[model samples]
Target: MIDPAILEPLADDAWPARERKRLGGWRLNASSGYSMRINACWPLAAPDRDVEAAIDAVEAWYAARGLPPRFKLTDGVLAPADLAGQLAARGYREGKDTLVMVGATDGEGDPLVRLSFSADETFETVFTASAGDPEDGRERIEALGRMPPPACFARLDVDGAPAAIGVAALGGGFAGVFGMRTVPAHRRKGLARRVLLTLLSEARRQGVERAWLQVEADNAPAIALYAAEGFQPAYCYRYWSR
Candidate 1:
């Protein structure tokens, strides 16, 4: 089994945030406040100060930035066991349970899918067009641009029009997939699967051993797709906000 403790930092580094700080092992991140992962605090380990004091600091930090205090609690043995109860007592309600999946990276890619070292205009166009929330889309697009090297953006087209897109950030023998999107008219066409496989193929080329991605628990179709690709749940995390 893939260890959540080891995989959490890889995923965080793959998707960068605009502003970041640390309270000992706890990670504080904030950006446009649309994407919960970037804006929420990740309590992966114990803080340096008292747990209550650390929570207070997190609240004040977000307040200073005109955003709500939020925490990302990974549900596993590595996470601080009592932190959830502490947040609950402080009026933090749990939201958005997301499953983290892990899979092997040993497959061939679709030659039809174009892979770029950066996010190109067509990639951005398809991503923004398919996004339901403009601000959230914008935030994610910017994050995609900020990802460091050893990364690639995948785009697949049908009838000379953009159909689907995905991004992979690679490092330390791991590949983290993000920003998988498909045009509305192109749904159920296996475009996403092509994009995913293409990305994984590239990761294998770069010597990546494993691939990981986060998907909301309610997304049944996405879960099925990941499962079919040999991905299994490594762990799950939830957002906590007052």
Candidate 2:
């Protein structure tokens, strides 16, 4: 079995959205439909019977909400041995394997970057401005805002222009990095790296030694950048949906 010390903190870091319901040992998170991480049931533990019951309850629950049934499976938890088999029997297919990476929090940000925890209108404005599509952007902003305490928003400005944006959540002895984005003209300028270091530095200052983040397995640029920063992939997780 994977150690609870590692499992619980990773879950808290990645799936920090509000809980719509707790069925069996799974967490049904549906605060937003834009991202499966927030919309699926996390099957980390439970008996086979409870898992089956949860499978039924979750399908109905999401059906009532006019959404599809989904599950997030990770390698580290007390999941049933046949969890994947059961989902496959229900015709649920896997999607988007993501790597969970961890590393030491070192190096302060570039002189141009700034970290802010106020989460005011200006932060939302700048973040959504560069993010694609207003509707999805609003969903992301709301989801990020709804995350539990010990969080902040980071921005990088060049010549008084907002160049990049990132969000960091501190919990469970780790600084969780998310929403790292650099504007079109700012890509290749290392704004993403600056934002990451800025957040990691702040996290370290706050007495955290470790930092973590998630990246799509196929995102080579992001994976390369993080690898260069000394982050090693700890595990993988994927979503399954019918």
- Candidate models: Cα lDDT each: 0.89, 0.77
lDDT of 2 by residue, 1-242 (tens): 23443754465545455456765567777754766777788776673457778789888888877778888888666577688899999899988898888888998766677778856666677768765688767777777777777786788878887778887888887788888888788799888998899888888889988888889999999999999998988878888987
Candidate 2: misplaced stretches above 4 Å? Answer: 1-10, 13-15, 47-49, 129-131
How far in Å is the alpha carbon of 59 misplaced in model 2? 0.9
Task: Report the Cα lDDT for candidate 2.
Answer: 0.77
Clash count (model 2, backbone only): 0
After superposition, which runs of candidate 1 have C-alpha atoms over 4 Å from their true positions? 77-79
The alpha-carbon lDDT assigned to residue 131 of candidate 2 equals 58
